[model samples]
Target: MKRRPRRSVPALLTALVLLAGCVLVTVVTVQLILGERPWISYDAVAATLHDLHWTDLLPAVAGGVLALLGLVLLLAAVLPGAATVLPLDGLFDSGAARGGYRSTLRAAAAGVDGVSAARVKLRTRRVKVRVETSRTQPDGLTDAVRAAVTDRLDRIGPATRPAVAVRVRAPRRTS
Candidate 1:
């Protein structure tokens, strides 16, 4: 079965950060021009801002808010189908798993007879797996890597073979 790529939660979060920044900028500019303080006294806000010399706070505030929002997005990434949270942890997990599987396959490729180098990418039913090699990859290298990954994943935990993709790499010193 063809697997659908997970949505980019970080991208969404970044958009939100931009939105919040716009809101913040508008709020500050409006407050400065209109002499209205929604959260505190206008005179007090004016006095504190003027005396504290905290004009640089705009970026700080924006950064702080973005950081908090990032944390929330990360949490959502961990938990699937989070209404308020985006599943970003899963993305990292998929990447790590794919990397691990690729490395293992590469080692297997090295051991395979007539194989110069191996690049493997594996995607399990759980996440993403992709591996690429620039070294001399001989014929049947793809099959060899696939067999290796299947065997390893089977030994370790439950995973799907179809989700994993083993791409044959180009041979080094191509004429």
Candidate 2:
């Protein structure tokens, strides 16, 4: 089973723009039918459009801007976002499970000796663990963190196990 895709921001913005345009047109039409002055003067707009030329700088700039906006919206709608859930061996998957998996891996890395702080990044094919320690000689810290994280990943039993990479950083000493 695949995770549900998240809503696109550009798609939402496009909907809002269309809704606002429809509301504006409806209000103008109702005002015109009631013989009341509309918010926007149609006659003036018509006159301006009639007098405007395609070669004019303003029209060219406006057309270019609109084209660019359309292209951006189209790309945003067509692009797929990053995966949100980690697939398991069976047909079971939930947000809670993903969170638990991440936390478990992070805890395992942080539990290693000489690791003062641990940060884990879970990707589709690789898990990166960054550990910070105050020890001057952090020789075996990276291997320890990697082994611990790998062990946890094995226990979790994800459908596709990601490779684990560990990096140990020690705080710089000040003179």
- TM-scores, one per candidate: 0.36, 0.84
Q: Write the per-residue lDDT of candidate 1 for residues 1-175, one digit (tens) a residue.
A: 1233465867676788889978977787788788776444567867866765445877579778979977887866675541221122222433224445446656765565555555554432432223345556456756766676666655544323344566555647666
What is candidate 1's CA lDDT for residue 100? 53
Model 2, residue 136: C-alpha shift (Å): 2.2
Query: Each candidate's lDDT (Cα)?
Result: 0.55, 0.83
Writing each residue's lDDT as its tens digit, candidate 2 over 53-118 gives 999998999999999999988777677655666666756553325567778999999999888998
lDDT (Cα, 0-100) at 23 in candidate 1: 90
lDDT, model 1, position 175: 69
